[model samples]
Target: MVLSELAARLNCAEYKNWVKAGHCLLLLRSCLQGFVGREVLSFHRGLLAEAPGLSPSATCRGGSRCSPRARQVIKCRNEIMHSSEMKVSSTWLRDFQIKIQNFLNEFRNIPEIVAVYSRIEQLLTSDWAVHIPEEDQRDGYEGETGSYLSASQVNEVKIELLKEELEEMYLQAEEQEMLPEEISNRLEVMKEFLRNNEDLRNGLREDMQKLDSLHPPNPKRDSKEPGRETPERKD
Candidate 1:
């Protein structure tokens, strides 16, 4: 019924500029469908201003003289408008609260995320002591020691080197006055690379730690027997 009224109002040349007028009527129609519609309607009508801005009194224009049905319609319209406004306001507030809660949750997790990233960085950059064979130690060290390094460790070093190179390139590009857009694009790529590197490093560290803990390092054995004496000591 409200939709029909809106269509009629819109079709009328006199109501072309009264688009807002139809909105209030539409709200009333929706409110009337609910179980509390009658109560809501009554409350709004009682609160309605008679004759535009005047209080409901005998002296108010048509306030005391309107027919019962006309008065009911007027009251219903007022309630519909108020209820619509309240619904819009409440919906907006709920959305705003949800957004605020999400922002707070993100803020709270930032420190823990940063700490994990730091741990990842430490693990990536850590230098493990490689024990060279007795023969290899005597020869002049040429390339990287053949002593085995974990694949994760090598990848970490590569990432660190790439980061340093990227920083240098960025500085050089800035010095040469590269276009702002290009510089921004390059920075974005660098940031993405760093983020990926951190993720990879963290995952590798976790896996390695788990493996190490599962199979602990073997205890060292004494080079000499407790009851045995060295031949040189016999002299």
Candidate 2:
């Protein structure tokens, strides 16, 4: 539904083929002023020249205070995604609370976007780490396994979620410039996740193919390596 709206608004001819959230952002870049839409906007490296400037660190600490609110949102997302500890500081999360609201306000006219406002507020105002009851802990995930997800509608939602994860994997491999180890670990997690979800495994063959093709490239050699060798051998 969201994609349909974006397709209509952006006049994205290939929007029907777009399967990930990043695709929407990619299209949005072409509309921004001073942008030729050529460079890698996926990294949010090109949004420093407009509207509500990015918040704390839009790719770097003490981020641009004059870029689009979207820039702040994107940078905050990148920070969380790239965190090795899989955690964020309270100050950072609190700042995100402010930034996300500001960003969402930018699209107040979009009903679908605005609909999640209350939900976002609920999430942000609470503890970042969910505190499950002791009973739930003891029963563990076994109590809920496959029982609630049997509906076709639920399956479709799961499929979309898998596509989003695949999209992020693509970004990590092709855009984030992650270390080879980091990419490899994430790849294994994704592979195992797919293997467990038979429905997803069967439904997302094409998506999985793209992920497979994104095998991280070999790490680039650093010119400043400590043991760098300079043998005088002719090729």
Q: Which stretches of candidate 2 lie over 4 Å from their true place?
A: 1-67, 127-166, 171-182, 185-235
Q: Write the per-residue lDDT of candidate 1 for residues 1-235, one digit (tens) a residue.
A: 3223323322333222111222323332343345245555675566574345645443423344545444554553343222311122334333333432332244344443333333323322232222223323311122432223333343444344344334444554547666555544554454454444453344344333433343344569988889997668554
Residues 1-235, model 2: lDDT tens digits: 3323222322322211121122223223323322323333644554554535775365555644545887787886565444433334556666777887787677576555555565455444532221223323211122311111123433454466556666787777788677757777876776675665565567788877786677744578787768878778998
Error of 2 at 105 (Å): 2.2
Q: What is the C-alpha RMSD of each candidate to the true structure, in Å?
A: 35.2, 15.5
TM-score of 2: 0.39
Candidate 2: give its CA RMSD in angstroms.
15.5
TM-score for predicted model 1 compared with the true structure: 0.20
Q: Each model's TM-score, in the order given?
A: 0.20, 0.39
Worst 10 residues of 1 by lDDT: 13-22
